[model samples]
Target: MGCSKKKIKYELSKEFQFEAAHRLIKNYSGKCINYHGHMWRVIITLHGHELDEKDMLIDFNELKPLKKWIDKYLDHTTIIWENDPMLTFFKKNNQKYFITKKSPTSEHIGEIILDKAIELFDNQRIKVKYIEVKESNTSSVKVYSNKY
Candidate 1:
């Protein structure tokens, strides 16, 4: 006999935005080498095979941790390289900054967010599918996991 309970494949997403400053080092040279700030936007998507008792794949409020993570790491902060000279100026002024192991480009940031999502929600049936980081209205990068 077929199962009486209804089955649903669910997908949910949340959006977040924060302001941050960064300069790319140990890479290409361009305007990005100059300190700049962007009202960065991120979209996090989660997919699940089963819903919780509340019939929800994930509550919007429960996703707050992701936002908190971004705010703590990237918001209003300067992103720099491991031993870039800019680190001295940023520190002297006591600026909030993240010294990324790799370049802090939007593409890399997308991967960072994706990793954070996997770490943040692995216990839940809701699995992170992708993370999109937008530096501007016209430019963005997406990182996703197909295995989920």
Candidate 2:
């Protein structure tokens, strides 16, 4: 008899892009402290051991919510650390902004996106494996789920 191996894992990924501006609030002394913008690129991966009833890990349409959320909140907006001193200025000026608990670095942004993906796709059959946030063509950060 011949030994056979069975497929046990599957993964699906989707890429999205948005435009946003941010400035590092602290722990940096570079030009990043000043406001800047990037055409952000995000790639999210889903992992599972088995396919669903439709023989698919997940329908691509199921991921549309994530893209829509990003476009609505992160695109064409300034992402600022919650405690940044400029918060008052933005509030007073009525500027479009998104507040983050941590500095708006690529690493933190990746973590935030990953968290949102988990919230939107939480299920026993599949989970968010990782999220990669590319601040620029040359710089990017990848955040992995602790459950993985």
Q: How many clashes (backbone N, Cα, C below 3 Å) per candidate? A: 0, 0
**What lDDT is obtained when candidate 2 is compared to the true structure?**
0.92
Model 1 per-residue lDDT tens digits across residues 39-87 = 9999999988787889888899999999999998888888787778888
Name the top lDDT candidate.
Answer: 2
* TM-score (all chains, Cα) for each model: 0.89, 0.93
Reference-based lDDT, each prediction? 0.85, 0.92
Once superposed on the true structure, which residue ranges of model 1 sit more than 4 Å away at CA? 1-7
So what's the TM-score on candidate 1? Answer: 0.89
Candidate 2 Cα outliers beyond 4 Å, as residue runs? 1-6
Quick one: RMSD of model 2?
2.1
Q: How many backbone clashes can be found in candidate 2?
A: 0
